[model samples]
Structures are given as C-alpha cells and as structure tokens.
Target chain A: MTVIKPKIAVYKFTSCDGCQLAFLNLGNDLLKLTDAVDIIHFAELGMVNPNAKVDIAFIEGSIATPHDLERIKNIRAKAKFLITIGACATAGGIQALRNFADTAEWVAAIYPKPETISYLATSTPISTHVTVDLELWGCPVNGEQILTAIKTLLLKVKPAIKRDSVCLECKRSGNVCVMVTKNIPCMGPVTQTGCGALCPSVGRDCYGCYGPSENPNTDSLSKQFQQQGCSRETIQRRFLFINNQAPAFLKAGMKK
Target chain B: MSMKMEFNNQEYYFLPHVKINALLDYLHHQGFSCIGPQIKQDAIVYEELHDSEQLPWGLRDYQMPGQYRLEENNVKRAFSWANGPQAIKPQLFKPKESLWRVARDSHGKLTFKNVTHEMKPIALFGVRSCDVAGMLIQDKAFLTEPFVDKHYQARRENVFVIAVNCGYSSNNCFCVSTNTGPQVKAGYDIALTEIDDGFVVTVGSAAGEALINKISLKHATDEMQQAMQREINNAATMQSKAMPFDNTRVVRDLLMNNLDHPQWDDVAARCLSCGNCTSVCPTCFCSSETETPALDRIESEHSREWDSCFTEGHSYIHGKVIRDDTKSRYKQWLTHKLATWWDQFDTSGCVGCGRCVTWCPVGIDITAEVAAIAKPAVDDSASE
Candidate 1:
C-alpha cells in the first residue's frame, strides 16, 4: 500500500502575496504537490480549514497586526514544521518602512482619523513569533524555490538550495559582469539568489528580492561601492531599503 | 561536440530577385513562422510578419543616451536599420503572460493547467546580432533553469533562425563589447550578409542545410564572400560609443561592502517608479501569480504573471512593503542585478545588452552608474 501524502497548509500575513502564489506558479506541480500533500489551507485559493491539523505550513507576509500575532501562534501550534516564504515573512517587508519613523504620524498622514485605526507599531517576520523550520527568501518567491521547498518537506530532508547572493547565479549563467562591464550599481553580491538573477539578466541590477542570505558581507560590498564612486549618503539610503532591518544592512544604513 | 560539414561553396548562390515577399513565401513554405519588423502605430515592433510591405526600409532610428525613436531617412534600400526597435524576446519568452492556472471545478476539486501553447516552427527574419545574443542569454535564464518554462522550451525547440549580418550599427548597441554582434555567430541556423548585387548565405545547422538544398541558391564566388566580410567589418567598426567597464570580481568587493554610501538618494529622486526598464529587458524572469476571486469562493482559480521589485507590493509582508522608500527600492534593484545575482546564479546578471540604457525613460545608464561608484575601496577591515 502507498503511504498517504502528508498534510500541508499555506498561510499569509502581510506581503505582496507573491509567496503564496508561488504554489500556483507550479502549474504542473501544483497538482503534484496536492497529490503529495493534503493542502489543508490556502487563503488565496480559498482552500482554508482553520481547525484542520497540518504537517507543514508555508507562511508568507509579515506580522504587522495583533490579529497576526495570535494567528501565527495558532499556526505554529498546529504545524509540525513552519516554513517562511518571501521577504515579507522573513524581513519586515516594505511595510516595515514604518520601523524607522513614527507610526502615529505616518498613520495620521494617510487616514482621515488615525485614532480609529489599530495596527502594530512595526512589521516583523513570522520567525519573530513562531519558530520557522526553514525560510525561503525572495521579493516574490521564485516558483522553482517553492518546488524545492515542497519536495524537501515531503521527503523530510533539508533543502539543498544555497543561501548565497545573486552574484553566484550570474556567474553561473556565464554573463559578462554587469557591474564590471557597464559600471552599473548592483546588489547581486549581497542579495540572496532565488530570483534567477532576473534583473541583471535583462540589463538592470538586482533589487534584493531574495533578501540577505547566510553570512552576507554587506560592509565589504558597501566599501567597494564607495570606491566605485558611491557617496556615503547614497550607500546609506540604499542599504536602508527592503531588508534594511536585516542586521548587516541595518548596521550599514545607520552608520554616519 | 563540434560538428563540422563542408560547404560546397559552389552551390551557395545569391538571390537578388527574391523580394521581401518571396523570402516570406519561401520561409513559410519550408514550415517556418516568420517574425519580422513592422511599424505598429508609432513604434517598430518585432511581431509575426504582418506583411513584407511594412518593412521599415529607408528609415533610420535615433537612439540617444536614454531614448529611441524612428525617423525617416531617404536611404531607399530601407531595412537599413542595424537593429529592430524591440528585441525578439517576447516571441520566445513572453514578457507578461501566464504560465499556469489553478482552478476548482463544480465538484469542488482543484485542478492546475500548465499554460503552454503549440510551437509553430518560427522563422525570425531581419535578425540583429545583439538580439541573437539576448536570445542566447535568455536561453540560459529559462531553458537552463531547473524548472524549465515548457512554453518557451517548446517555441525555441522548433525555431529556424535566419541571421541578417548588420551593415549598420546603432547608437544604442553595445553588443561589440559583449563580444556578440555585427557578424553572425554559431547559434544561428542560417546567416546572411547583404552584398552589392546578391546576398551571401552561410548555413550552420541541419535545418539550414535543408533550406539551402530547397531554395535555388546560386554559386557564391570568393569576391562575394569578401564583399560580405567587408560589410560586416564596417558594421562592427561603427559600433556604439560607450566603453564597457571591467566588472570582474567587482561585485565581491564593491556594492556588497559599502551599503552606507549616499549616491542612492540621487538615483531615487530621478526614478519615476514606472517599471519600464525591467519590462523591456531580455533576461528578467521574476514573476508573481494572482488568483481572481470567483462567483463561488470554492471554485476560484489562480494565474501567474510577471512581477517587478520596483513595485511596493512586491516586498509586502503582513501589511507592509519591505522597500517602501524609493531609494531602498532602487538600490535593491541595481545591487541585486549586478553584484548579488552573480553570487546566487554563478554569473553576471547583465549581458551588456544596452536595451535598459535606451529604454530607460530617465536614461538611467547602468554602465555609467557602476563607473560612478567604482572608486578605490576604503580599508573597512579596520573599521569593522
């Protein structure tokens, strides 16, 4: 007799909804994933069963609300393994921009009456509240990554994908160095690699979609950019974006 | 892996009588789909051959530091432009199209349909060298990737490439620096160079051999070959004016080290956040899938489409976009493509294709930006 596929669930908090959709990008693989795992919950596709127990949960988005705090706890309680997908679930996400500024003033600027609104002061990743067994990073997670994550989960094996930056992928594609060939400012060196180095391939630089991976040496990259003629101010502001709150980029951004 | 076949040099003939229409007929008859350049309202596009009559002949396109426009030039041999207004990427790897969809049936069962179309053998005419290089670059991005884009894989599998050796190079072209253009290279099935009275055709693949056998080719003399070579030489010599920078190992040392530099503010101030540069590029493959809510929540389906990091929603978590600040967004984009992408994929993100340079509404030249940042590295080891 064949072993029944494991049960899996997908969760979202605050994100571009890219990671959750990653399952959909698995056009052929979605069915295969469902066949391999009983999809217990997926809000975007209206596949939700809040009470159902799950073996693994793929969480996307950041936690910026009190409700999110409680929901993540519940997800963690039921899931044997929780995997975070996309930058939002790993970093504070773009919404985390509020971390550097005053929340009340920012809310008042947008809402007619800020006092009526209720929100967390800062956006944070799922790991901040729940223990994430694995983390898949990307601005909008790449489909191949989703595939790998699912396969690893089913087999109860650690995913073998690299946590290195996008620069490695660029070199593997045999492309002429964009920064060296054209002097373009790029983040491929420090940014994580899952997006297939898309931006650089199209004649543009990477925008840190995958966030920082492993022990990224952002300081060395920053100094190199300085030598490449980047002003101190330019470097600070750029470092403050996306994964700005990430320890290394945060340190660089906060420096005078 | 090197397959060689001797060209009977004598049977390789020129067909001066074959007008654009005849060539289209010939390509079509040989079970090949033709992709030619045509004027669509205001811009010249690489689309399925609308008609040979619409070729942008006798017109010169103007491409400056950050702009591209087609202008009327009295040169009658029209088809004189070195490159098309757009690259031939969307045909093979569509820019904004769905790859798959997730849906639920009346019985409340979920089903996924991998969105792929039948591949009609394509014959891309009026080909430019940089575009070919762009194709080669994209081949690595999509075809080389582990989860292959079955759609693109199908289209590229049966395509017959007919390369037109450039007699003229454009102001926006930097293919020469990438070691790619002006003269056709190995990827092409058949490469043609325009000669004075007739054309010189060089066949490289079995499909190209089959084509030469079918088309009534004329004897190619040494003089014809020499003339074609001189034409390609002239085109190569008259390349774009920008000097490509030396970025080897620059990613490991530069942008990764100095994240505190303030040059990003200047770039952010000029950025309109209009995602044009990324969309027109040949190798960007980042995508997002969206689910359209259905009449019955139980039967909703999901569809995947293109995505851009420049957008605020791209980095959203719970309720926030990670790189909400324009400066951070722009910085994330450029740095990731140039430096970090190499670390991830083991290759440079760019192929020296200057389409991003020409297409940028703000004319954000990446090559120039890297040069702007390439200062001597400060000894940060002591600071750390």
Candidate 2:
C-alpha cells in the first residue's frame, strides 16, 4: 500500500551556492519535501552520496572547470531527469563574464598562483556539455519556483513556467512603470518574469537576473536605453550582468 | 408618459464639491463598494474609495509618449487628469481568477467544484467617457449570445458606473478623433462634468435619478451648463493626437489593405513585444489558462490570467508558432485591434484613451503607426 518516493539530488559546480540555498530556505517546505522525495545527495544539507542514481538531479553553477565538465556528463548519465537551477547552470551566471574576456589574464590578476588553478578557457552553462531536461533561471532561483517545478514533476506533468516579460508581472501587481515615470532605464520589457518584477516593485530598475525572456527584443531595449541617456557601457553591463552567457543577452551585450 | 416627454421633464442637478462624500456614503449605505481614482505609486489608479478626500485633487498628470508625470496645479479639481493604465475592465474581468477546482480522494475518485467568489456590488466613480466606451465594447465581447462568461457577467451585472467627462486632455489623447470622449455620451447610470464650483450631473438611468434624488442638490443653471460645455470643448480641442481617419470603416480598410507595408518593419524594430500596450489597453480581452495541482496531487485548481498577443504562446497552435517574429505579432495586434475587430465585433477595439501610448516603455504610438501606413513618405532618394 506504500508508494516509492522519487529520489532527488542537488549538485553544484562553479556557482556561489545561492541557488542551493533556495531549497534550504524552503523552511517548512523542506521538511514536507522530505516526506515526498528521498534527498539522496544535497551536500549542503549533510546528505552527500554524489554518485547515487537519482530520479531527478538539480544541477547548479556553470561548467567552469575540467572537473565540472566531466562531473556533469557522469551526473547526466546517472539521473533520469537533469534540471538546471539558476543563472549559472542554465546561462553561465555572473562568473561567465569571464567568457567575454581573457580567462588567463583574469586568473593571473586575481590569483597569486595562476598555475595552481585548473580551469576551462571559458565558463559555460551545463547545457553546453549535456542535455538539460528543464532550466529554472534566476541569479538564485526563488523557493516558490523550485517548489512549483518539483510539485508539477511529482504529478507527472510539465512545469508551466510563463515565458512573458517582467513588465506583465509589474502590470499585474499594479506597480507604476518606473522606466516611463522616473526614466530608470528598466530592463523589465525584455527580462523574464520569474523574479515577479522584483526591482521595479521596489522603485529600482530590473537587472535581468532571471535572464532574457522568450523572443526578447534586445535590440529595441538597447535603443530604448540609449534614448534614456544611458551610456553604451552601462547598457551593455545591464545585459551582461547576472545571466551573461544567455544567447539573447550575450548577443545584446556584445552589440556595438 | 411618452419617452420624449419623460426625457424633456428630466432635470440636471449641481452637486457641490464638498457633497462628494455624501454620494460615497449613500452608495456605501446601499451595499455598494465605491471605487475611484486616487494617487498611488505616482500614478492615478483605481482603488477602494472610503472617502472622497482620497481622490486626486490639485494634481494634474502630464502624459506623453512613454512618459507620465504628476504635477501639482493651482487649479483644484479631482478629475483633471485624462486616464490611468487600468479602467473598470479589471474590476469585472479580473487579471487572474480560479474558474474551477478538481480533487482526488484516497479511493482514486475525482470530484469537481466551481470556484466562484462572492462578489460585492461595485460603484465605480470618476470613470472617463473612453473607459465607459471600453466597458460597452467588453460587454459585447464577454456577454454575447453563444458563449457568455458567467464570472464576467456576475461582476458586470452587480456594477454601477458613475462616469466623469474629461475637462482636460493628456498629450497622447485622441478620444475626440475616435468620437468616443471629451463628454460622457452613453453607457452610464450617472455622468458628471466638473466645473469650478461643483459637478453638473446628468442622470442617464432610473438608478442614477434615484441616487441623485436622495442628495439635496440645486438644479443646474444656464451658467453652470455653459461652464461644463466650455470645459468639454477645451478638452476636445487640446488633444494633439488623432487617428488617420475619423470613420472606423476607413481605418479598417486602410489597415486591412496595407498589411504588408514597410511601416510594420519599422515599428517591429522599435517594439519590445513586452505586452505593456495590451495590458494597459482597457479593451484587449485575451486571457490564458493554467492548471496547478497541489504537491500531494490530491487537488488541482484551474485559473485564467490576462494574456497578450505579443507573447509567443498566444500564436502557438498544434506545436507550431504561427507568428514567430515580432513583426508578425505586432501586425496581429494592430490589425486585430483596428481592422479585424470590426469584422468580429462590429466595432473598433480602440477607444483612443491613449493608455497604450503613455504606458508603453518604448512609446510605440498606435495613431502614428496608422498614419505612417495610411500615408507613406515619398521615396525622393530613390528618384535622385
């Protein structure tokens, strides 16, 4: 009469461990999650069987090193569903800023012993190496979004993540348009909605932490930023900030 | 009494500025929640009104393409601004609401329940003429013969509309050209034109007459009537923007014929396709539905939220996105709003309140787009 619980694992590579905190921060929900699934390998939560075969594998961070490149491929083979969580695992995160620059120079400048480091020439998302079942995008994916994904997966259904812009959420929440009213040069028009229009709701411009939305018109948004008197560097930085390696944002940031 | 005689016998009343609260109190006593325009987060938004003092007074909104600013004016008036991003549309057709829910028990049997919220009768105060026009258009959309939306109808039937005639026009306003504003023409229980001293009220229905009769008011004098007319005329004349054509048929034909014009490419380049224009548009009624099951998989709720044609999902049918590009999506929105809307609903979707223009983050003006398509510039460079 008992049902076998789905085995879940949390893996990290070159990320800041912030997205893993999204699961830990699920306070009471974390306890309830234990009742629903078997957490076979979340190192932060003290469970550390990394090689265990799991029903679902939640991967965080970019494939920034030789070890990450090999580890992700092994994890992909072990897991039935490999879902990438946060900006790093999906779009190479803020560290992917190194992808645009000379990684050798960055390592030499930052580290006292550059030869001690064994890293890839360019930081890249996990999707670059192995197939990703789904991608939960954000600088640190929110707890609610993580829960929604797990809940939908439990029901044997695909998670319904809206691919609309942050502007839609801002309108729904009845937040005044900061870009239009205060000339804040908000990226809400091109950014995805997972952050729930967080920055604009607090009178700040969106930094596009959740990454570029579906069919984002980055060229038009760049033009808008220029019209708002934003410097070329500032406009580029806006797109290249958190989810730098995302294709649409990378193309936008690299534009002249 | 004959209809003409009854109309001739009707009297217009003047409700002084101070007596506005009394109207709110009367509506409250009648079990109707009053909602009116008030300054919130630097914009005039419709919220629950417990007192008339909450209305935006001595505040004028300066709206342009992609900009809105609230400035204090010496003139003390409540309804001086043109309109906000939202109207009475959201009040009835909610942004998101659960339609129904289904639950499964341990026995593996399922049960369904309709999730209808207990709605209170809402008395919308300070609604503009264009918004009133929007309400009528929505009524045609949601309350039509074959498939009437029960949730929308439930809220629509229990609503009281108190419209206000515009005394001033914002920079993007073109209601005069649309022939739908500057004065409250139809679709209201009561219409109020604000003068210096008070509001000159026109009762459009028996319900309006009943409410006005409860409040002791002076009959509108000839001077008061003249002042109201002057204010309305000023509003009409001050508008700087206009559609390409006054006639809806002409506009429909113009947009329908020039479907493949280069102007669409020009607009598509500037457009972010963010759905801001559709969200701000009072008449745009597209919605999308989603079903969310509880973590336990024992219960699930099906809900609908506001959707826009700008979204790629809106054009998705049978695993194929028909309008895969921004140009095609923008074309769908403009054509459907101005041209195809008439063929579907027998009325143009745009009411020309200009919320779409002002609230658009990049300021893609609908009127200007229409004008470009209607009259393309001469290709003198090619000749040279």
Top model number, TM-score: 2
lDDT of 1 at B28: 87
- Please identify model 2 stretches exceeding 4 Å from their true place: B1-9, B376-384
Q: For residues B1-384, could you state the per-residue lDDT of candidate 1 as single tens digits?
A: 001333333235564534556667878886777987766533456778846677776677666544566678876553567653355676776544555666767886878776665667788877776677667667767776676777777778777777778777767666666566777675677777877645688876776776666765666788888888898888778775543354445654577775666567656655544444565566666666544333223333445545556655567688676887667777787777777767766555565557677655446777666655665445556675
TM-score of 1: 0.56
Task: Place model 1 in a CAPRI quality band.
Answer: incorrect
Local lDDT at A246 for model 1 = 72
Interface RMSD of 1: 14.6
lDDT of each: 0.68, 0.89
Looking at candidate 1, what TM-score does chain B attain?
0.84
Candidate 2 global TM-score? 0.96
State the DockQ of every prediction: 0.03, 0.75
Model 2, span B1-384: residue lDDT tens? 000112222577899999999999999999999999998878899999999789999889999899999999977789888888787888988988899999998999999999979878899999999998888889889989889999998888878889999999999999988889988777788889999968999887777878898987779999999999999999999999998787387899998898878899999999999999999898999999888777777999999988899998798899798998899999999999999999999989999899999999999999999989999655757875
